[model samples]
Target: MAGPLAGIRIIELAGIGPAPFCGMMLADHGAEVIRVERIGGRIQATDPLLRSRRSIAVDMKSPEGVALIRDLAKDADGLIEGFRPGVTERLGLGPDILLGDNPKLVYGRMTGWGQTGPYAQAAGHDINYIALSGALHGIGRKGEKPVPPVNYLGDFGGGGMMLAFGMVSALLAVKNGADGQVIDCAMTDGSALLTAMTWGFRAAGMWKDEAGTNLLDGAAHFYDSYECADGRFIAIGSIEPQFYAQLREALGLTDDPDFDAQMDAGRWPALKEKVASIIASKPRDHWCEKMGHTDICFAPVLSMAEAPEHPHNAARGTFIEVAGTTQPAPAPRYGGTPTDAPTPPPQAGRHSDDLLGRCGYDEEKIADLRKAGVIA
Candidate 1:
């Protein structure tokens, strides 16, 4: 049986990062996603993360190619694109044109700074977007430079995921008789939205303005990583008094009065040092054997390779092997209509003919476009 979003159709204007990620999400959940690639097929071949979509390379600069995309959009339920402001309009495949063809189509635009901001036209990367969103400012250790959390915070987490959510939400609204509208999913805006809880804490006088100086930000001695004797890492999150007491007993730290003040900001550094010294006296394996599966909230810091093989993750089938590479499976397990990974990642324009055919272009039209260099 098809997945829950079986009948949805999405046209993805291929770019990099967020746009492809959004398309992958839609395709994984049973949407028929057609990736409109550039004529030269400007995408890497080994990106496993870009799996689960059909591709059609077209030269959007050509009138015929633009017409072909407009034809595809006529029947598409949604359209996702990640380009600078006015790029799609200039290509003549903007929301106005596509939505004019399909009034119920969800036009989802993914970008770093958004469609209409001072930095919208400025060239920026994931770091720049998250930085401006106040996410980077609250991420690292106090008195140290802000750490870029790779591209996860802005690119995939905020930009692509939010775009997918907006597209799905708009699709639902359209299904319920609402007219489709454009979804401007900005990484900067989404990243800021991701920090809504922190903002609430700040307003409630429970969160400090400084980075790594709050309970969940690694300021509290109870919530941080520690090094073991074998040089491996362990994470601890004994936040509540009961859990802290359990941790103290488990670690033989009952006699340490300094450790008793769980919320003493002035004593955190010393407490952390003491905890580090105790943890380092034992190997990671020893600590795991001692406190694994307890209310102490303890765990060994496993690497990416170790995570898939981890007992908990393995039991839950959180990762799967695809195309000889291990990657995370689609998440948020369903009880009835379960999700499944699609076919392996295709080579650029691998499905050009098939995708064009589905878009209502006959074999002769496809040959004409190919012969005219309008499509690959």
Candidate 2:
């Protein structure tokens, strides 16, 4: 608790995926996010998504457990849940109930669909959510099925990150004397918002509705990946005229008329073929050595194992070791109140006694609740 959100406490209704991800982000930035899991529940310790948070396990269906959460909610600045629309209300922990007690609390609801949409209660995942948001429609190669970006767009980007932003924004509102509010963070809505720039491109007639046919979507020869002789790949993003000129100079294609007209979209496929052939003649390292530090927008497409060891990543401390696991560091660096390295995730209910003590329960009262199987 050393960063901007140091004293802000968040009560998380234990859940999988984006909800937990949101909690992890808040916890990473110095929020005291207390995770309330069901009795005997466990979130895999290796999942970095749950890092830096303490947990309490309780029988959420029991009236005692419901009261336990309500008790904690009385002093929390916010609450986040990823259950389907009505699940929290069913648990009697919905915004109306919690906000009634804590008028300044920011309540964040993460879901695939929103609270009152027709598909609000439907079962869905990242692919389905982005598909409905029109994000998936323009994602793949022409004549190919849309490839899912492995849950990044809808789950983390849309759902978890959006929920975190919404929660902090609401907290700022509370600081400005606004009452507590509910944030319906639907993946569909978030995904669509994430496509705002592309939507603008489409509106301005600079983008195509079809997949793999736009300037930045792998259609342009200078803005795509090329295979190397070693079968590895390198990415090229020579989008600007100067960068494209540097690309031509680096590859000795300056004299070639085929590459001279870099903006001719119709000639992209043939130019891409010629460029691919040239790149495939050399290994990935060869191109890296030739243009790695230039304005050519060139870099080897490093794999996960290689990414952390890269010089830039190492220099930035972009990845860190926690519980013997290497994962990304807390991001959007703070200047005055920098975040501390996150602690490893604790076992569920590891701080049950300590957390309960802060909630006004004495040792004897907590022991009785533990005896009655109310908390673990």
Best by TM-score: 2
Q: Candidate 1 local accuracy as lDDT?
A: 0.88
Candidate 2 local lDDT, 251-279, one digit each (tens) = 88999988888889999999999889999
- Let me know the TM-score candidate 2 reaches against the reference structure: 0.99
Give the clash total for candidate 2. 0
Residue 247 CA displacement from its true place in model 2, Å: 0.4
Regions of candidate 1 where Cα sits further than 4 Å from its true position = 42-45
Model 2: residue 118 alpha-carbon error in angstroms: 0.8
Error of 2 at 7 (Å): 0.7
Cα deviation at 144, candidate 1, in Å, is 0.8
Each model's lDDT = 0.88, 0.92
Q: Give the per-residue lDDT digits (tens) of candidate 1, residues 176-269.
A: 9999899999999999999999999999999998898999988888899989999999999999999999999998889878787788888898
Q: After superposition, which runs of candidate 2 have C-alpha atoms over 4 Å from their true positions? A: none
